[model samples]
Every structure is written in C-alpha cells, then in structure tokens.
Target: MKRWCALTKKKTVLLYLDRGGGAVGVCGGLFTATQKGQKAPETAEGAEARFTRWLQSEQLFSIILSSMSDLQEALAHRGSSPPSVISAARSGLSRLLDHLLDQSAGSFSGGASEWLKLGLSGRALDLKALVSALQQHFLLFSQRLHSAEVERRSLRLEVTNLRRGLQQGVPSDHFLSVCEELHQALSREQEAQTLIQDQSKQVRTLSHSTQELSQARKEVARKERSLRILGKHLSGVQKEKQQLEERLQRAEEGQRDLSRRHECVVNCLKSAETSCKQLCHACISRIGWLEQEVSAHRSHVTALRSELQDACLRDNQAFVPVEEFPEPFPPADPETPKPVPLS
Candidate 1:
C-alpha cells in the first residue's frame, strides 16, 4: 500500500515538471507577491533583496519533490478520500506547470536567440534547478552591464580634460621669435655705448693739445717784442759811428796842410841866411815870426791825432766787427795840402 502511494506521489511531482518551451503556473503567487512589495521601494539594494526572496521561494519546488516521495506513507493512514485527494493534487500540479511556462514565455522576444548568445539562455532538467540557474545568470548580467556603463563615462571625462589643456599651452615658434628680437636689441645698445666712449676719449686728447699750442704762441709773441727793441738801439749806434768817421777824416786833412807849410818855411830860411850875412835886421825878425806860426800849427796837429785815435778805439768796442774802411787822406807835404773825404 506504501509503494502504491509512493507511485502516485511521483506521478503528481512529474505533472509540474517543465518540458522545453512549456508552461508551469503553480509558483505564480510568489511573483505576484514580489511585484506588489516592489511598488513602494525605490533603491537598487531594496530591489535586490526582494529579488533574492523571490528566488528562495522558487526553490520550494525541491521541497515539494521531497514531500511527494513520502506520500505513500501518508496515504496508508487515510480512510477513504484517495481518489478526490489525487484529483486535487493533479489539478494543483497542472496549475504550477502552467504558471512557470507562462512566465518564461513572457520573457522571450524575437531576439531571444541573440539574448541566449549573450548568456541569457534558461534550460534545466527540473523546475527548481531552472529557477536557480536563471536567478544567477540575471544577477551577473545586470552587474556587468552597470560596470561597462561606468567605465565609458570615466573615459569621456578624461578626454575633455586633455582638450582643455591643449587650448591653454603657448606656441613654441612665437616664444622663440620674441627671445631672438630681445637679443638683437641688447647687442645694438652695447655697440652704441662703446662708440660714445671712444668719441669722449678723442675729444679729451684734442683739448690737451690745443692748450699746449696756445702757450707756445704766447712765448713767440714775447720774443718778437725783444727783437724790435734791440733793432732800434743797433740803428742809433750805427749813425753815431758814421759821424765820428767824418770828423776824423777832416782833422787828418788839416794836419797834412800844416806840415806842408812848415816844410816850405824851412826851405826859404836856408836860402836867406847865406845871402844876407851883412844884411838888415828887419829880414831876421820876419824869419823868426814865420817860425812861431809853424810851431803853433804843430801843436794843433798833435791834438787832432789824439782825438782820432780815441774815436777808433770807441768804434772797435761799440761796432760789430767788419772789414775796416781805407784811410781817406794822403801824406803831408811842407808847401801843399790835400782835401779829406767825409765818411
């Protein structure tokens, strides 16, 4: 009797099992409970907890399979309601299978094959295993999709930052051109300063030389004045020497006349002394007077000789040495006189 009851429980459990693409509706109440509870919750964590609860409830199919294995023991103690109970069990099993198949069919779309390639396939040997596998696949797929979206957003933000940096950087060629212009300007400034310094040095040297030239001109002017004074004095001395030379020549001529007269008187006295021995005394007195005049002229001639000698000595001392002039008078004669030449 236990064996018969066991065989009937097995048949009831088999009625709820999912064939490929089939419906099962016994677990529909649990999905309804989750949907109603999710209406007030807004956060991802709350939604995840609800989904976990739903998966756990779906695992109750395994417990139902175990209960069916003990149905034989339960049927043995029953009185007379076996047929009615078996009918109710069969109806409940049918409803459960119908609900599961309906839910699976609702999840499928025209692109169901593509979804399966992306690891969304839902195939299992039993209802419990199928629910567990589907739950795990859904959780992992949702997590991977969210992570991929976050990574794409981060990459876009980094690209924007790099573009801004490029806009702010300076151009290399323009900076180099500015540096070259500054260097050229500095070089020109240095050259101008050097030229100014050289000009200043040359001006100083020329000023010093000009000062020395002015001093030399003053000395030359002073020497010219001294020479003019000396020239005037020399002219005066020359005129005086000329006059003295004239006077000396005249005196020399007078002395020659006197000597000539004395000689004539001596010749006449010699001729008279012989011829007038017993002659008159008057003749003798006239001869004596002639001798007196001759003596006086001799004294005058001696004085004039001394004056000429003195003038010659002064000329030697005062005049510049030069060739002497020739004497201007002849020798004295007793009876004749010669004229003297003036200088």
Candidate 2:
C-alpha cells in the first residue's frame, strides 16, 4: 500500500514510491502510481502517517478488484510487511464484501492467516475468486436461457406456418403479432448497429480531427481579433456619423432662425414703406396748398405793380417790370417733384 496518487475518477501518475519499487494500479475511478526505483525518506512520523492512510485505502480497494490477478498484483506490493496486518486487511475485505453483497460471512475461514498465497487451490480461499466464479455461473445460465427462448420462438413460428398451410388453417394472431414485433425489433437493432458503425468510423478519425482542432482554434481566434478590430472601426464610424448629424441639425436650426429674422425684417420693411407712402401723400397735399397761396399772392402783387406804374406815369416816375422782382420761392411745378420730409 502506498500514498494515494489521486482521489479522482482518472489515473494520475505521481513521483511517489512504493514497497515493490515498481508500479501497480486499479481500474475505474481509483488507482495509484509512484516514481520507479525511488524511495521515500525514512522518518518515523511520516512512515506511520503513510502506513495509516495506506491501510485504510488498500482494504477498500481490495474489495473493489474484480480480477484475481489485479488483487494478487496489489497484494504483492505489500513487500515484506507484517503478516498479521495483511491478514487483518484480508479479513476486513472479506467481512466488508460479505456484508455488502449479502453473502454468508462464515463461508471462508477468516483465521487462515494466509491471504498472500495466490490461486484458487491455495490454502487461503480468496473471496474475490468466489465472486468471480459466481459471476461466470450466472453468465452461463443467462446464455443457456437465451438459447432456449430462441428455440421456443422458432418452433412457434414453424407451428404457425404449418397451420396456415392446412385446409382448416387458422394462424394465431398473437403469434403473428409477436413475429411482427420481432421483425421490428430486428430492424431497430440494425439501425442502432449502423449508428454505432458510423460513430466508430468517427472515432477512428478522431486523431486527425484532433490535430485540425488546434488550427481551427487559431483561425477562430484570428477571426475574433479581426471582428474586434472591425467592431471598433464601426463604432468610430458611427460616432462620426452621429456628430455630423448633430452638426447638420444645428445648422438647420440656425437656418430656421435666419429665415424667421428675414421674414420679420421683410414685414417691418413693408410696414415702413406703407407709412412712407402715407406721409408722402400728406406732404404733397400740403405743398399743393402752399403753391395755391403763393399764386394768389403773386396775382395781388401784380395788380399793385400795375397800379404803381400808372401812378409813376402820372407823377413822371419810371415804371418797373414785375419780372424784375425776385420770386419768393421756386415754382410749384419744380416743388411738386421734390422729395417729402420723413417723419
């Protein structure tokens, strides 16, 4: 017995040493391994602890071994250990198997003290050997029972066929139904076998496929890296588009504002133009009235001048022409086309 290499479902090789100075292992979930030709450091405390653990584990493993050779091989690794201890371990294994399997515990002599001797005819009756013998017997019985059932079914088919050939033939519906069921079962089995063959074919090609898997992984990783880079580029492009869209929206708002201002300015100009037209009409009317007043005053001055000229003639004074007098303002025709004053 040696320190456990692993307490797992798979075999694990370790650089530990055992008494046999070689290797021994168990199958299906628990096994041990050690470094070849290597030995543990001799220390009292370490040896006691290792022995205790091994003692506990070995007794359990001995009960688990289905093969006599595996059991013998395991026992051989004990290598010059105390017989009393080995006997105690074997007895424990026997008792445990008896209890677990519900076998008669007293069938084998526990006090024989010769568990190390291998083979069925040996002085020590190994309990594992008895279990193996029982399993063989059970398998043989099952095979015989299966052959008997096949023969029985074959005879039933023949009887059914022969009855159907007779004049009074009336084939049993139950038998025919069973035969149909058997045919269906056979077809299903063939399909299952086909599926198994396909799986086996895949298994045969597994090494080549496994080799390709590494390259496939590399390709996948490279594709992932490229995808990541592309994603980053896409994100950047989207951000730029968003920024451009925002700027466009802002420009649209500014244009709307400008249009509103333009509309307001146009409305104001229209109102100002209408007011200017009204003021110009008023000023033209006032200028026309002033022109009429000036015309009347001119007429009065003309009459006075004529009268003065006659008086001057009577008194021997020189007459002056009305044209010689300077006009008080420019003529109305010129003033009529002049610009009006703004309010």
Candidate 3:
C-alpha cells in the first residue's frame, strides 16, 4: 500500500513537471527579451495593456501568498485543515499546485518516517518542478490579470459616472438626510390637501343654508304685503259704517219734527168741528121764526079779500033798484052822459 501511494505521488509530480516545461518553452523568449532591455516591438496601446497586466499579476501573487499563510495557520490550530482552507490555497495558485497538494495529503501517510523518505528521494526533482511551475503560474496569472484589468476599468468608469450624477443633485454625505426631509414634506402636503377638502365641504353647506334663509325671508315679505292690503280694506269698511250711522241719526230727528206737526194739525181740526156744530144750531132757530111770520101774513090777506067782495055786492043791488024807479025822476043837465051798466 505504501509503495502504491509512493508511485501515485511520483506520477502526479511528473505530470506537473511536464506542464511546467511546456509553459517555460512558450514564454521563455519574452522573459529573456525583457531582462536584456530589448523590448519587443509593440504599439502604444499594447504596451499600456502589458503594463496594466503586470500590475494586476503582482496584486494576485500577493493575494495568493496571503491565502497560503492563512491555510498554514488553520492547519496548525485545528490539527487538520478544512476543505475551505484547501480550496482557498488551490484557487490562489495554479492547478498544478492544487494537484500536488491534494496528492500529498490524500495518498501519503503522516509522521516523520514518511516525511524523511519523501524528502530524501525527491527533493531535487521537487525543487526543479517547483521553479518551472512558478514560471508557468506567473504566465497564466498575467493572462488572467489582463482580462480582470479590462473588466475592472469598465466597472470603474461606470462607478465614476454614477458618483458624478449623484453629486450633480445632492451631496453624498447628507443624501440620507435629504431623502428623509423630502418624505416628511410629502406627508405634510397630503395632510393639507385633506384639510382643504373638509373646508370646501363646510363652505358648500353654508351656501345651502344661506339659500334657504333667503327663501324664508321672501315668504315673510309676501305675507306682510297681504296683511297691508287687508288692513286697507278694513279701514274702508269702517268709514262706510260711520256715514250710515250719521244718516240714521238725521232721519230720527226728522221723524220727531213730523210727529209734532201732525199733533198740531189734529188739534186745529177739532176746533173747526166744534164751530160747525154751533153754526148749525143758530140756522135752525132762524128758520122756525120765518115760518111763524109767513102764517100771520096769510090771515091778514084773507080778511081784506072779504071786505072787497061785500062792497061790490052792495053796489050791484043799489043799481038794480034804481032801474025800477027810473021814469018817475026829474031830468038833470043835457050834457051829462048816461052811467055804464054793471056787467
């Protein structure tokens, strides 16, 4: 088993040697030219690229050295190194170093005996392989470093642009404080907007109330006008009633005067009736006296008529006796006319 392990370790070292030999052949010409100061023909851009790559390679070498030391410390403290330590060490150097370290740790036995045997037999070979491996690693690190430098430059430009844009508007030192103040201002603005909305609602309510009050006042004014008209009508009616009362009073006074005149006319009619009765009695007595005088005159007229009739009859007898004695008497005067015979 120990023999098999030893063989495997040798094989791993041989493989690393082969790889290192190939890298030396490829980069040997360039390394020789730089040392002799016989710089290779290159453009300005190519020379600048080479210089940046060299600087990055130096930085990488330092990082690798730091990781190796950290790994050694971890091994001493814990008596065994964790996988992270091994990974850190492997990532820092080339794959060749990783293969060698992995084989030695995994396949070999521990202790002084194994160490002495490995050191005595392979020390010179290991030294030669290590030197070659370092050269190859340097070349690989340079290539990787060139690519890393280009990416870093691009990232640096982007970061510079971002920083400039931020500085144009606000200072980086107080950026957080400015943002906080802006947030507070926005909150206050929102509160003020809400208060304004509430005040608008109150104003609208007041306007509605004012309109209602105006309508009420109009209604009151209309009612006042109607009351004024009614009062005028009532006053006219009162005036008419007053005139009627005055006329009625005058009519009553006329009726009292007519009653007094009617009573005086009735008393005059009674006196006239009494005077007519007295006149009627006096006329009746005068008519009775006139009838008595008419009877006395008629008796006187009848006595006178008897006297005239006796005288006439006596005269007729005397004349008739004288006719019998007419031839015996003496004659008187011739001229005396004969007496008229009585009829």
In the range 185-253, model 1's lDDT, one tens digit per residue, is 888888888888888887887787788777777777777878788788878878787877777777877
Error of 2 at 39 (Å): 99
Order the candidates by lDDT, highest first — what do you get? Answer: 2, 3, 1
lDDT of 1: 0.55
Which prediction has more favorable lDDT, 2 or 3? 2
Evaluate all candidate structures by whole-model CA lDDT and list the values in order.
0.55, 0.58, 0.57
lDDT of 3 at 107: 35
- Expressed as tens digits, the lDDT of each residue in 295-328 for candidate 3 is 5655555565556556755666677675663343
Off by over 4 Å in 3: 1-227, 292-343
By how many angstroms RMSD does model 3 differ from the true structure?
29.7
Tally clashes: model 3.
0
* TM accuracy, model 3: 0.25
Question: In what order do the candidates fall by TM-score, top score first?
Answer: 2, 3, 1
Clashing pairs for model 2 are none
Output the better candidate (1/3) by lDDT. 3
Model 2 global lDDT (CA atoms, 0 to 1): 0.58
TM per candidate comes to 0.23, 0.32, 0.25
